[model samples]
Target: MPTAYRLLLPLGLALLSACAHQPGSLAVHQQSQCPLSLRSGQQVILTLPSNPTTGFRWVLRDGASSLLDSLGPEVYSNPEDAGLIGSAGQSTWRFQARQAGAGHLLLTYQRPWETEVAPAKTFDCPLRVQ
Candidate 1:
């Protein structure tokens, strides 16, 4: 069915986007539209794009503290990690309305075996949930 194909398209694309890379050097050449906004009490899906197999992690942060961590769409085995980018070299994280405040997406990429955390970027995704 057309609807089923449409739904499966994203998943197929995600799998095709995965690429193995050296750890600690996972870098995003660029970032597209990020930090999507959603209404309070409403649920929405936000997709974070990344380079294939970059080991991207999606971290939801509420101010100074973290709310949750997720493993996105093309994460493979090998190195043990909590979060992995799904197929399509991107991960989709869900969001819900919370306390009418601001939240942030903290994306980090560091080399293997080192905690230096190089080439890290933070995106301000604001939602005035009311």
Candidate 2:
């Protein structure tokens, strides 16, 4: 084989090996339906639209801890034009698939202080961890 070809082949294989060990993340939005599948140790982010000024927030109705582990608490971010009043932002939750099993996540957007009213929005995700 040519010396140039030998040198390039080793470099290419090394780069691919490095990438294989890196962790991966998946992002799911409100429009996305449930029954999602993921490999073990992969991370998933659930993002939903929210406007806290109106007293509506996304709360986790149910979390299947046996199949997934919470990376941390949920996070919220506002749009770049934040000066506008009553503008909506994004709320995101991060979780890591821990084992091989089926699980579900339920979330609702509602006012915590109000009990009788129904949620303004909801996210229901059924998950399979492999």
Candidate 3:
């Protein structure tokens, strides 16, 4: 191989590595008609398996009310589902709510290296008393 090609090879490799797919995304479920369950308390309970990624952050909004905030590491290999991240970024609004009432909910997620925010999803629904 040419000496020039050898000298430039490592630089080329570095450039290629920099272009690797960034970590982070928001997904939602289509045709999902499941309801969100809310209980009378300050905590929301739900179950999910770990997603495959670096980390995740979540935000919960009640459309008409101030945001109910919760943030945590998004360990994709473990049970990492942000109740506020929504299913595939799709949300049922009333699921895992800490209050019983009528309200709209939106879930969003983002990671450290993400260039764009996950879809700003909004779900209008009634919080069913569980």
Candidate 4:
């Protein structure tokens, strides 16, 4: 093989090998991505539309604790460039696949004080880890 071809072949193979072995994080934005399939040690990121200024918040009812581990509490971020009060934002939660199992990651959006009332919105996603 030519000198340049020999050098390029190993570099290309190295990159392909790295990608094949790396477990990438899975991002879930809506219910359409339900029945998530993840590998052990892979990160799972869940983001949902939220507007906490309206007194509604997404509460974690089930986090698939047996199959995944929570990385941290929910994170809320608003678009600073919007420059408007009570603007809609997003809430994000992170988790890591722990073991081979299946469960549901469920959340309800509603006012915490109104226990008697039903949730305004619900997000329930089934998760499978291997």
Candidate 5:
């Protein structure tokens, strides 16, 4: 093998390794990435599209409390450039993998007062911590 080829091979491997998931945290944005695999003590950040101005709120149904612990309450943030009122934003929740187990993180988007109405949307993701 050429000397330059040998040198570049190691550099390529290093870059590939850096692209893997980080050790201490993982960010999830969509349900397609569900059935998450996490290491113990790793942080899980979940963000979903939301707009409370429409009278719909993301309510936590199952938080996977058996294997994960909530780090804080839901946080909502709107884009700074979208100066208009009632614009869509995002809702984020933070959690930490506490033990080796499997569970599901579930949430529904619905109006709090509309008990008779079904949720407009739902987010359910399976989680595995090891």
Candidate 6:
């Protein structure tokens, strides 16, 4: 094979792989770890630590984006020994990039019944779809 062809082939494959999701996926907890850009059809997951036993849950304050679509309903999971009682776990939200445009996601941690109280935590992720 030509040297140029070999070089280009690997580079192209790398770029394509970058657009695909990694195996055994998990949500990103830290906002700093969030990707600034993503390719169309790529999915982004945001995970936050939560303890629903206390009545506080992560809610989607603003996740509507023309460039993105919610993949499915939010999911929650608990660690091993789920029967241990009062154990904290995680909540996740997934979104798939639909087209080339800007995207926005906002999440707030609060109790749904407490309207007068402020959220305990918040996550905001802004993204660009390519």
Of 3 and 4, the candidate ahead on lDDT is 4
What is the per-residue lDDT of model 4 for residues 1-130, given as tens digits with 9 covering 90 to 100? 8999999999999999988987899999999999898999999999999999999999999999988899999999998997999999999999999999889999999999999999999999988898
User: Against the true structure, whose TM-score is highest?
Assistant: 4
Candidate 1, 68: how far from true, in Å?
Answer: 9.8
Per-residue lDDT over 1-130 for candidate 3, one digit per residue giving the tens place of the 0 to 100 score: 9999998999999888876633222232421533544444333322223222425444343432432223332222222474543333221222223344555444444453564755333333333433
> Judged by lDDT against the true structure, how good is candidate 4?
0.95
Candidate 3: 10-residue stretch with minimal lDDT: 88-97
For each candidate, what TM-score against the reference? 0.41, 0.80, 0.30, 0.83, 0.81, 0.74
Clashing pairs in 6: none
How many clashes in candidate 5?
A: 0
- Expressed as tens digits, the lDDT of each residue in 29-48 for candidate 5 is 99999989999989999999
lDDT of 2 by residue, 1-130 (tens): 9999999999999999998986799888865656789899899998888899899998898877998899999898888878787799999999999999997898989999997999988788889998
Native-to-model Cα distance after best TM-score fit, residue 35 in candidate 2, in Å: 1.6
Best-fitting candidate, scored by lDDT: 4
Supply candidate 3's per-residue lDDT for 82.
Answer: 46
Question: Tens digit of lDDT per residue, candidate 6, span 1-130?
Answer: 9999999999999989976655333357888876557777777787788899999998897775788788888898998877768899888888877799876678889999998999998888877887
TM-score of 6: 0.74
Give me the displacement of residue 43 in model 3, in angstroms: 6.4
**How accurate locally is residue 15 in candidate 3, as Cα lDDT from 0 to 100?**
84
Estimate the TM-score for candidate 2: 0.80
Q: How many pairs collide in each candidate, listed in order? A: 12, 0, 15, 0, 0, 0
Better of 3 and 4 by TM-score: 4
lDDT of 1 by residue, 1-130 (tens): 6999999999887777653321121222234443444443454445555443554554444431223223343242332353553444444554444445555544444334445565455545433333
Q: What are the lDDT scores of the predictions, listed in order?
A: 0.44, 0.88, 0.39, 0.95, 0.93, 0.80
Alpha-carbon deviation at 96 in model 5, angstroms = 0.3
